[model samples]
Target chain A: MTDLNNQPQQPQKEQPGDQPKKSELVEKIQQLGQSNVAQAPDSNIHVLPIIGQVEGHMQLPPQNKTTKYEHLIPQLVAIEQNPKIEGLIVLLNTVGGDVEAGLAISEMIASLSKPTASIVLGGGHSIGVPIAVSTNHSFITETATMTIHPIRMTGLVIGVPQTFEYMDKMQDRVVNFVTQHSNIDEDKFKELMFAKGNLTRDIGTNVVGQDAVDYGLIDAVGGVKEAMEKLNEEIDKRKPDEDEQVIQ
Target chain B: MVLYTPLSEVDIFPADQTAYDSTVITTYNQTPVKAFKLENGSYQIVQVLSTDPSIYLHPDYQPGMQFNA
Candidate 1:
């Protein structure tokens, strides 16, 4: 007996209006709290993929010029400054690049306080040798190969006595650094650099992952897992004591 | 045939060796310079300097002029 259809229609509550009001309130709250919130932190571990030639002084040959020192240096510095980044894993798949550039990069890596590990995949050759050995610990895939060679100069050969002297000094710098960082001795490295009977065109030794390990150039033969594990171990070693009181 | 003398033997600088700077000029003729005399009586070429003052010779070449070039 109630005429439902004839009943006065109650004012429909606008659900859409409530949603917009709620969104606006949320937006205002976010704006008010934005200044108080700290910036998002960096990751705990940074994995930098260094592919192609490590462009230093020499321009990489055509078809292999992806990575360069200019790009790598800033990234490394950023990683160094980031407090959350406890360690670094450099994934190297380079044929090598400019000597001074590679050396500079390697020196930076060697000097980092943070634990660092490098994994050489594909092939790490020429100047790549220094980078491979720069990290605290190094790993190379079983299929990976590293070419150890004497420092070479491209372009014109003045053949002047001074030019030869410069070459010698530069080569000596590279050799000393490599010998100091790696397990290979200076004499053996020089032999490898000047090895006349092995390679067809170049004078160098090609060491596979295992061979590199045996020569003491690389720490072990492994892949991504081993590299990460080593990096974690380094991080764990450097972890600050939670019980210690901060002087600041 | 050219005869070469060690920088040390020629006494080009001085016997005392302190007063003399021992600085020698060099050219780019590929001739070896004997800086020091060996026990075997053979002179060892230390370096060859450049003919031009702008160019410095390597430490491994002889300093004096040779008849070969």
Candidate 2:
């Protein structure tokens, strides 16, 4: 092998007076060809994972793994416009963050004309409540949990009754949206929000798995397999309506 | 050149979708297997690339020798 290394390498036939940089460009192209990410997007169902904390306008530290709303917004637009995509599956496993940003995402998903479904894994706490309910159908794993709590601000406030009123209005938006989207009623949900002993050191209820379904916050208690089947069934139902539109 | 690396370090699904269209997955036994999603949207192995010469040649191999030896 050492003798082979010592042997003078065979020279390649050069294409008439190519610059060294041009040969370097050729190498770069070859490297790009081997990457799986560079391939054209395919597949009918897109899985959008809402993992970690949902970062709003403020950038979280680099150490934090966040599903930035900006990244998701554009992808959601693409998913809406792209005719190739037939359905969407949102998988949520978030500690949840940023009220405004989370609300924005939930609104966009609720307004999408395409068939959509969501499955909550682990804990969908804080503002994640609205997002999980926004989908056409929702599922939560039997072990998954959801925290129903009032809105909170981290920064300085005027500390007045007016500030309290403003917080109350914002909290209403979240409560109203969740109730409207899911089977849960407004009064019952608020009852859960102010429930006692469910969470220590907090004033809210931490609804678990089947408890969530029983409360009608989530449509069912299931995992990925069940969620996919539900999404596909919804997609199939929408097909005839689309074909009818084309005929007219 | 052949690179011997663990599967965990390399991301098999770099794209956004849960199911890949047709990404060839190479196994521990040095078998290169191709998979495709079915009509029902489940994946099944479509081909085994055993006939093709491996792009990766084990560096420590010798004739009539066990891999562990």
Candidate 3:
């Protein structure tokens, strides 16, 4: 009978490329253990960049390029938790992605205790508008443009009453969020969102930076300097009066 | 949960006609207005009013007025 318990053991060997130098392996492990904490002072405001598409939904197919909110949500929580972080500056330059993810991010920023400001760079289109205005104050580059449009679905639309009702409810939620955060009136925003003769093919209005300011969609038509200054002012106002020192 | 309402419904706007000359007509106790020139050689006037802090404040504050500690 074959001895089942006495199995032959194979000799252990490492290939030339597979064997890393002892120091190199130790160094890599050490680096991996180090945390990548942002080192901005508590008094100094930190800028968190939220670029690219906001990702939502599980099982993201290859065709669906989205901005992962999981990564962003933790970063936002970190900003709120960090004692050294006085304020947060959100720099947005996105071609808008997932709606639920974007809205979730916006709500998080809006509810943060720290003074937050957002600057819309190249463009703050679609769901980006709510995020742009979600901060305590918001600014856009003079050249930046914001596209105010209704919610859209990329997949096939079932032409059923329930489908239409769901779409309407979803749209209402977005519109409510945007109007609540920004100065844009809901009716005018709706008009722009469903404008008949704005774009030849699209069903929305593209407001440039200054126009956005005029429409109350954005606070100012300025860049980094203006946004930072506003954020600092808000932060200063929130600080305890006893701790306030007059700066020359 | 607090239901969300549109600002347009809560806020009021001016409703008056202007003469050929570019002068804004206003009623007593009306909100101030800021005027801007549109691209089509037409002027668009927007009412400038202070937003109630309640609109944007965290729910811990009073129902009306700006949130002041």
What's the CA RMSD for each of the models? 27.0, 17.2, 23.9
- lDDT, candidate 3, at A238: 79
The per-prediction tally of clashing pairs is 10, 0, 4
Candidate 3 on A1-248: residue-level lDDT in tens? Answer: 11113434435566676654664446444533322222321235756566666666732432333456765676677668867668888888877766888899899899999888899999888888888989989999989988888887654467799998998998898899989998989999999999977778879998898999999989898888998888878888877786345543
Please give the interface root mean square deviation for model 2, in Å.
Answer: 20.4
Looking at model 2, the pairs that clash are: none
Best by TM-score: 2
* Docking class for candidate 1: incorrect
Write candidate 2's Cα lDDT for A12-71 as tens digits. 667767776666556444533321222222357776778899987765543456777866
Q: How many backbone collisions does model 2 have? A: 0
The predicted structure with the larger TM-score, 1 or 2, is 2
Q: Which order, best to worst by TM-score?
A: 2, 1, 3
**Which residue pairs clash within candidate 1?**
B26-B49, B32-B62, B33-B45, B33-B62, B34-B44, B34-B45, B47-B60, B47-B61, B47-B62, B48-B61
lDDT of 1 by residue, A76-169 (tens): 7766886767888877888876788888888988888899899999988888888888888989999999888887765557777999899899
DockQ of each: 0.01, 0.02, 0.01
Error of 1 at B40 (Å): 80
For residue A103, model 3's alpha carbon misses the true position, in angstroms, by 0.8
